[model samples]
Target: MSNVLNTFLDENLQDLRTQGLYNEIDPVEGANGPIIQVAGKQLINLSSNNYLGLATNDELKKIAQNTIETYGVGAGAVRTINGTLDLHVKLEQTLAKFKGTEAAISYQSGFNCNMAAISAVMDKNDAILSDALNHASIIDGCRLSKAKIIPFAHADMDDLRAKAKQATESGLYNKVMVITDGVFSMDGDIAKLPEIVEIAKEFDLITYVDDAHGSGVTGKGAGTVKHFGLQNEIDFQIGTLSKAIGVVGGYVAGKKNLIDWLKVRSRPFLFSTALPPGDVAAITRAVEIIMESTELHDKLWDNGDYLKKGLIELGFNIGDSETPITPCIIGDEKLTQQFSKRLIEEGVYAKSIVFPTVPKGTGRVRNMPTAAHTKEMLDDALAIYAKVGRELGVIQ
Candidate 1:
């Protein structure tokens, strides 16, 4: 390697280590469930995005196995070529019904879904008013569009309205769009979609919502857009099959014309290999499960509330989270990392999240309690938290 490249890597690596920002990944021994094994130690896992615990569901696993036997492992080619399989069609149809949209289109992953969908619609001739705390994928997508991005304070409806008025009335761009995450993942706060929709209507701005964290956790499992009954009002509804759906893929659900356009223009769909047939089949079934009943959804909320109440009672700062995601805020970076490390050592796998995932000095150990966590598990984890917190002087 070149000397300049080596120096750059070495300097940055040392800087991140000194600042406690370098994250060391731990490999889970088996399926990622309520109880996970890391380095041969059994731990109560609060770090997984498996909200409903469907990733390990027996029925979905069997379905995937059967489908793979029939369709083989890969999709063979890109969608525009010969990769579009019957399972893919079924998955999109199910997604459309699940999201309450006229049609839908699936992609390889949630991150690239935003990358493809945003740039496919908005361009240099347009401007987007994005929420300040939107996901990195959305931020990168906006940059890729070459559209003028104007950020509004996180969930500040008044600020969004003001920006919408300015961008739409300035007469500089051909179109204006407002985009936000349905639920802010870092703090777990639900976006003010109702207020945002009102502002979009006033300014005639196109509405886009990425409900990656809200689907199956809110709106009786439909999503945040449906949570507010704004399905008809919002133009674009984006979601991921990976998180709540417990599969691996992403999709955009909207009107038929939008779906039709994305099938042709979205670069990921046109270029990247399609999601595997078995995964597609399993994803279709997962959405059906979410739509059929709310048992898992209700249980997930119950677990979240139970864990949040326990953390708060023990004098931990879990920020204002409306969903099952609980973030234990620790302001100092080094202390936050220490808190997480101690928790892991004590047999609780709650990892630390710091800049640039979140702002500096606002480091947190984000917890995601799923439906699969029993009361006994939560009680055990809480006890461990109390011990760790006291030992670290984070609590009384």
Candidate 2:
């Protein structure tokens, strides 16, 4: 390796270690479910994004296996090439129907979808009014578009309205776009999409929502847009197949014209190989299941309520969470990390999130409660939380 590269890596790593900002990853031994085995020990896992527990569902697994036998492992080429398999076409159609849109375009992953769609639509002549706490991928996509990026306060409607008015009136750009997360992963708060859509109409701005955490967990398993009944109002409804869908891919659902444009111009679709056939087949079945029945979705919410109730009753400051995502706020970064470590020691696997990911001084241990987790598992996790909270003087 080059000496300059070696020095750069060494200095940055040392700085991270000295500041206690370095994260140590624990590899799970088997399937990542309600309970996970890590380093030969079982822990009540609360850190995964597997909201509906479909990742380990027998039916989905069986479907994937069968599809693999029929279609093999890969798509072989980019969608623009010979990779646009029949399964890919079906998945996109299913996604469009699922999102209640005229059409949809699938990508390799949710991150890729953002990178592909945002830049494909907006360009250097446009402007994007983004939420202050929008996901990193949105930020990157905005940057790639080379558009003037203006950030408004997180979930503050007044700020958004004022900014929207200012941007539209400025007359400095040909197009204006507003983008936000349907559910803020860190805070577990649902975006005020109805308000956002209203503002967009007033200012004639295009609206976009990334519902990575909301799909299959909100709106009877449709998504946040449907939850508000604004599916026709929002221009772009982006989602991930890997999260609640229990497969792997990302897609943008919108009007047929918009999807047609994306199909012709999106770089990822033009350059990257399509999602594997088995994964697409599994995702299709998963969406079908979610559309047919809300059983898993209901159980997910029930578990979320149970976990949040226990955490609150135990005197932990679980911030205002409107969804299943829970954040037990512990102010000091070191203390927050220590609290998570103690939880792991007590057989829980919640991870500490700090600066950059969230604001400094608002460090927290985020818990993701999935539908697969039973009442007994939650009880045990709550017990561990209480024990650690007491030992660390975080609770009574």
Error of 1 at 22 (Å): 0.6
Residue 323 of model 2 has an lDDT of: 95
TM per candidate: 0.99, 0.99
Model 1, span 1-396: residue lDDT tens:
999999999999999999999999999999999999999999999999999999999999999999999999999999989999999999999999999999999999999899999999999999999999999999999999999999999999889988899899899999999999999999999998889888988999999999999999999899999999999999999999999899899999999999999999999999999999889999999999999999999999999999999999999999888888999999899999999999999999999999999999999999999999999999999999999999999899
lDDT (0 to 1) per candidate:
0.95, 0.95
Instruction: Score candidate 2 by TM-score against the native.
Output: 0.99
Residue-pair clashes per prediction, in order, are 0, 0
lDDT of 2 by residue, 28-63 (tens): 999999999999999999999999999999999999
Model 1 misplaced stretches (Cα beyond 4 Å) = none
lDDT of 1 at 263: 93
